[model samples]
Target: MTLLTVRRDGEIAVVTLDNPPVNAISEAVRKGLYEMVGHLDADPEVKAVVLICAGRTFLAGADVSEFGKPPVEPHLPDVVDRIEAAEKPWVAAIHGAALGGGFEIAMGCRFRVAVESAKVGLPEVTLGVIPGASGTVRTPRLAGVEAAVDLVTGGRPMSAGRALKTGLIDAVVSDLESDAVAFARKALGADLPVPASKRPLDQMPEEFWQAALKSASKAGHQAPLRALDSLRFATENGFAEAMAHERETFLDLRGSEEAAALRHVFFAERAAPKPAALKGVEPRPFRTVGVIGGGTMGAGIAGACREAGMEIILIERDAEAVARGLDNMGKIFDGAVKRGKLTQEGRAERMAGVRGSTDYAELAQVDLVIEAVFEEIGVKRAVFAALGRVCRSDAVLATNTSYLDPRAIAEGLPNPERFIGLHFFSPAHIMKLLEIVPTPDTAPDVLATGFALGRALNKVPVRAGICEGFIGNRILKRYRAEAEALVIQGVPIAEIDAAMRDYGFRMGPFEAQDLGGLDIAFLQREGARAAGQEVPETLGDTLVRAGRKGQKTAGGWYDYAEGDRTPQPSAAVTELLAGWTAGSLDLPRTEIAERLVGAMAAEGQAILDEGIAQTPQDIDLVEVHGYGFPRWKGGPMFATGAS
Candidate 1:
């Protein structure tokens, strides 16, 4: 298709880019921009150019399809540089997002104007690289050194209003095309602003640089700090020198393991919401949702659906339960208000849309109903049974069971095809991971609807086949087991936790269990043992039997002093598990990390072979999003290259 076309509006030539979807800066697009400069410069009739894009967005960023490939001719930096050097001035009219290389190209223009809703940023640090094409250099020149440091290092886009305040854009207009053309016409004879490359960068104090570097430094990640370094270098050196340094940093990180891992996750996340298997299937539309139970998980589900603009019908067993459910949901909105994510007025408006009831009959008209009641199979089945009786035959019913077999829960429910399992992580509104488990009788449309809900909720949905713990929990079980095995082998508990923290997890497996409470998993194992299954006792089970249930009890594997959450190794635990412990053995921290990750990967491969998980990337996504597997290392499967 035609990527570029120029139309004349008097003396102003409006140049439009027509790359569909996100209008990425591909090699052909780069060459087109490069050639368009010379073409526009030669025409004296074209006094100026208004750069805008067709389809969804302006230029979003560099073509990710070209990642890890050889460099093509007329590279992005050269194209942007050629645009800046053109005889005719250019005004960039942006909508949607101009990010990474896209924003770099915008900075190359004489002026930038965007719609009020448009956003712009240099988000290369998210992909494990610094902006190579003048982002670090030009940003500081356009804005200031501190702003550039925050923008480039944080890798989050700012709104057009914020960009205007930061001096990143010239104006925010309603009519993008006509206003941009008029803007170009007005500036034709006026003194144009100095080119970003030639503009002197704002200098910051040495102490500011030091603090910026420290703030940018993240565990097991290098790109943020490196991005800050580029911005610092631009202020201390010439523009060309800093640009070269930025390019070198980008190229160096492009081939690094962290970059590759981030790319793996990026692609996985992009492909997650809509799977290939559900490509042609149309999902059933859902607007009003019914959620059973008023506890943490149920309230979170209701809050998330409400946040997604769906009307929520929260159901509980009785009047008191319904009141508590609404209160739980109110707390969620309160937190949102506290965090400035939602205004008090907006919270009241959203909360007004929520209707709580004790009767399942209230769910008769809901397009979908998710049961987030107790985890027991009997309680879950009972909830679905009530839903089957009250809901429409076409209305979708979902269970939020973390470990129970979905097939078993839907056994007696009518219209099994419309029933599916949506295992949302705790605080479902906040967590991104949603395991979409489909039973054998689940309809394609129902399965598609699950993915659609995931998209609506802005979650990473990974389709999982029926298994005891599904994908994430199964791997988590293995991870915890591996950590326990290391402890049994006489490795210091604190040392193992330290090793995992070094490997980039926010908390070690044991420490995380302590905070979340050990009885959560212990009860699951107890249920299995009660069902006449041959289940071996775990270290956590031993602790639970001794009335030590983690931070809630002020002790578990470690001791918690009063309100303090920090875990101090318990001497009583050492004596309790003395029967299983071997002589003291000290292994390298690297080996401990390898064993844990290797164990998780091994479990992931087993899941893949058993058809519980669709792809290696799916497992990676589940671990990263659900269980706090350090995203920079990819997932366990990607890190080990297993399955």
Candidate 2:
């Protein structure tokens, strides 16, 4: 593809990487870069080299397509080394994102300059590996040890402004090419800085390293800690030794189970937003959205749509309810302000775009309307009925019902083709998962519009066929069932939760249920029972019936102190459920995690077999993004090799 090409401007030579779509550092690009080092070093007329990318971003990272393949010649580390050893000093001109191998290559240059809005990072830890191409070794040499620790272990990009403050880049420029060229020209005569490989290393105390290690330890993922260890090793040893350690660590973890799981999730997430089936289909544009219901879910949905620059009409049954809905959305925006995510002015501006009303006529102008009312068939049907009469025939109608039949909800809608189910997780603005469910009658573009909205809202959209709970909750139902079965079989609830936490989940099933209130699911089951379905009783029903609804009631599967959220083993719960238990069996946490994950995967397999989900990856995404499945374990489907 002729990924690398050079052109001369006076005494400065510009090397542009032409690889399209992120310009990932592929083998061909690596070979070209390695050869160019010597070619540029030999050029008598080239006094300085300005390295930049042609498309949207500088080299984003190593080519993910090359992952798990046989190693090619001219490895990234050697190419970076060759760049550092070149006779002519190099200036990395960065824009968009320079991450992982890209950042390492930038480190190899004598100087790095970026546009003000550009970002740079070493994010290999996210994929279950440390950076392989002198990322750990050269980062601390370029920036300090503390900054290196944050860049490598935390696995998030730093803006160019922050990068300059941290000494990761020389300057933040306005016009990338010309400013970078002038930056290189000025640097040719100025006292040139030492190569990143030769820069003095920063040393930190043991306590500092211990704190860094603790901070880097996220759940049970190994990459973060290992990345920190590499940075620490760089501080302790010479550049060459640290480089070798980092490379060895990267190679060792690349074949590990955690890395493979992460890779599975990585590919799954990449393929989710735009599925292959809708390649040629174009979604209808929806700039104005109507959200019915002013409760928690509706407010969150409206806030999320508003954040995506969509005009929102938050409709409720009454004016008071509409006021409450606006307040609820205000609380969401207020929280963002508190977190420094939004300014008060920005929040006000966003809220200004949202118009609250009680009239269905207000929704007439909306391109789409999502109903987030009570999860009753009649209530939802009435909302849709009103929407059917007022909304445009071409308007996309979506239901945010978690468990009800979407097909039944859209029963008498005017245009059944425009009806779809968009099951957004609670705290919609914060949660990333959005299940895009298509009924049998849903048109392709309508389905595409749902996915399009999901993207606009910055969500991970998974296409799900109409089924009870769709993909996520269906698996969650089985997961909770398996946990209950464990409790019945003598596994301690606290012990089960502990095992899951060790396995990388932030909370176990019972603990999460207690936090979310056990009554929610219990009520769902009760609703199903009321519908004349053969719903069986579970341990949770017994708890809810006893008036333990969760944190609000200060009890559920466990007891809570006055205001403390810590779960204490409840004698009341034990006495209440003693009748359900068979005999006590002390099981290790690993076994408990394995059994639970296996159960979820088994349910996922059934879902796939029934064509409820398009692929195993979709199920995995559902669990990882919607439910609290540990990302490093991939999802139940990938973890259990059911994919």
Candidate 3:
């Protein structure tokens, strides 16, 4: 039946929207609302109206499925207009999230009330479009220009408290729907009520708007700049003009290539939580976890577990190592506190959940054990053997290996079925990618537990079969090989990085290595060579041997000044490299970029071909989240049309 119902809450008529999950604004909902608002405006018996959604949240946003479709009977803006122009004043009750068009509908109401935990924003910029339903025009009026710029440009939701202070919401009460009814009754007492659409905001300095527009373009996203344009139009023109401009800009960006790519990733991320095989299987219990070693990777893993509210037993080689690891974990929490991401009290609570010890015996009580020691096969096997000796027989054992084989690490284990690989990218606590790798011998429940752990940690988990480097790194190897080959042939190193950046990556490969240190990739190459594996002979080994270990050392492929991380093409580096000049090897930037991305795409397809990954989405998730392949480009697979 109808998604909207008008019920009498005493003097106030409560219009409840009942769509399961987040009540997205659909065509049927709009048609129903348009007719109901007309009826309510005609009915003299109704004093005021209170609009609230049933279930956990208000309308989250527009129906995404409606995107790119022909316009329906009642557009969101027209529906909002009808609601606002009603004879009786309308009050909106907001809880959970009122985002994008959802927030726009709330803004259309004369007054709004919300629960303390409620959040609202125009987050359409995140999906690569400005608000099409006059959200941009009204936001600056509801809140001042500064607040509007902060909310729209950042595309972050504002808490109810902030919304109240910024004049976006009138009140925050304990009970949402009833408080909204009370708010509606109180609004009816006003001498004159004004709809939000007719409201005007004070003007800001031209520099403010100019700076916002500049930042939007510099940020490399089209929506924010267009959002600024809409706000500017609202400041200069009237409501109707500004709304028209906003809608036109929204439609333009909605059909843009960047928007299409971003939408692909938006849908991909939503569908990546569970793979096809683990759809019906229940994940094994994973409350407490044991993390072996206390180095950077180990401490990051422990920090992630602790942040997830899991009790952690962080084991190291000795008491000193344990202390160091504990210190590292504390530092990570301290950084979080400094960044306002965690309170001091919250950091203390998280730290309290973790215990530092040199004993493997402490792992007996944990539900899972993740070994995050040195990424050597011998070292990883030794750690697992110790875990096998001390851990519970049923506890899931996993390795944080990037390239090594999991089956080799699981060799001679007491319960080979319990062993799996959880290849977390560097800065493990912060990074989102968790490659949930399973050996052929790994049990279903155990593999599901790995995926569960990734979900609990708020990481993107991609199921991968045992292989040389798995999906991400295998593709990365090929990409890097191509990069080095390009540079060696004739492409300038800086030009190569800038080319990739132009393609929408945050940083190029050479730039990322400086921050992560070049030694690791060097070691990986040398290790592969010693093992009789075919390894590309890049300029990295020579650079490392010359004491150019990257950002930590202030130089690698690119030179850096003291305390500054900007990469300046190095003269010394150029002098050392033979045949790196224009005469030696030169190619078009596009050719280089295509070669890099194309190689990555081919390797990714090969991984799928070899049954190393279940689906293209899995490989795309690994590259996008783990490897920093541009999300707006929908990862390399989607970029290559392989997806």
Candidate 4:
């Protein structure tokens, strides 16, 4: 009498979704759910049903492989409808993440219980779809419309505490399966749990909703606006009517080229760097590490090492510099504690693993050493040369250089094979990317160790071959050059930034430059120009000459008023660019934006063609992780189909 393992205790039955990994909602899973629900509804012995999945996660989401294909018979939506309309009480026991269609399926149940560590979200907007399976309609009913708007628009997952506060689930259980079964049995004897369909629509005070919409509009991202519209429909109409509207919107969005491109990017990121080289290569165990230099990058590297549970020795040129680095590190730990991300005890424990010193002899026994010193080639080469003489022969010597060639830095080292590049992004502990650059003489074991260290640091390790600026910076150089060209052609910096922001970048090139500082790019431009390379005419030079460095000085390409971070167009900058281009071609602002996109995409394509990047996905991952490129639009190459 068992369709897929029917086990009943008294009047309650447990129906498990026996799918592996994320328990993605596939056709077979849908059919199994429908058949099991029907069996439970008809059985006299079973008065209630508890639906749960057998895995770390309840349901990760839809099977991405099944997207864009014709619907299989008895689709997941139909199966969910059957469960929702069932006469018997049904409880959903969730652990891990319940997202997209998975969350919708949970909403269909009469009751929901989740573990304290469980996470839930709709997140369909990330894949360019509104939650088509009634999630857009139901989530707002549980959490208010504003919360729903934030979650669906941002595609952020919430913790069990947040879920409980929002009324998304009935209870947060210590033991998901047992507690869910008990809840189901108790519900069968008592009244049915409040059905999602019966819940009142979320109502915000008129002023709040108006303000929320206005804020979302100011964000200027399309997905947020679309998510807001879906929530609006749900509030105005009933659940069923809103669901119908959601379906239409989903279909329209799914057919868009942008959506297809975004989806392509999603899969490409997963396939970015092949693990083939990592096969059969075992990583070295790193219990302690030495970090040279006490600047921002060094402090960030020390924070990352300590965060990974590795004991660290922070080395600086002098005692005072070392004290400053340790102080900065403490500030970072304090901020983490204040944000509730770390307990006081946890922060203390992490900080305890880090020590400061000014002596080179202190690094003799560490497993690895990362040089985060100044970007000068001579300084880095000298550091490696000294490290080679002082450290163990097998110790991995890494240079945290953004653009300098690793092979050149390793030239005079005694053991060049152990030297490589570990380019950690700014605020290394926070950013997710670590570009692992290997020179021709770099040992396979060293590469393996760098990759392992990246995983240990909870970073996405990408293998990049040695180039002038490696992968991310190499492509970024082109994009920056294009922005400068557009400026020379008479486009306002503010307008160019706005267009890129509308296209889904977190910030425009000029905005990023202003925040990062105009002086930062001056050295790189000078280097390029000194090498007889044609320099793109950038308004950055004009600003730098005028002593308007950036936000630190309150002026660059844009002006920042006192106590304000918002950038306003600088008349001085506009006049400089206008005077420079007065005798040249006058280009429209829109054309400048279009050219910027074209140049970036073209440069990305050229990188792939030249074998600098392994695949189009690799380029995308570099942009997404290294830069603040928007994930929803995919990478530059993915957007342009340059791959």
Model 3 misplaced stretches (Cα beyond 4 Å): 579-586
Could you tell me every candidate's TM-score relative to the true structure?
0.99, 0.99, 0.96, 0.91
How does each model score on lDDT?
Answer: 0.92, 0.92, 0.86, 0.81
Question: Which of candidates 2 and 4 reaches a greater lDDT?
Answer: 2
What would the per-residue lDDT of candidate 2 be over residues 125-168, giving only the tens digit for each residue?
Answer: 88999899998898888779999999889889999999998899
lDDT of 1 by residue, 1-643 (tens): 8999999999999999999899999999999999999999999899999999998788999898999998898988888899898899999999999999999999999999999989999888888888999998889999888788889999999999999998999999999999999999999878887788898766788899888878887635999988888888888999788889988998999999999999999999999998998889999989999999989999999999999999999999889999999999999999999998999999998899999988889999999999999999999888888888989999999999999999999988889899999999998999999999999999999999999999999999999998889999998899999999998999989989999998999999999999899999999999999999898999889999999999999999899888788789899999888998897879998899999999999999999999999999999999999999988899999999862
Q: On residues 374-445, what C-alpha lDDT tens digit does candidate 3 reach at each position? A: 889899888988888988898999999998988888889998998899998879999999988888888999
- Each prediction's RMSD over C-alphas, in Å, is 0.9, 1.0, 1.8, 3.0
Cα error, candidate 4, residue 399 (Å):
1.2
lDDT of 4: 0.81
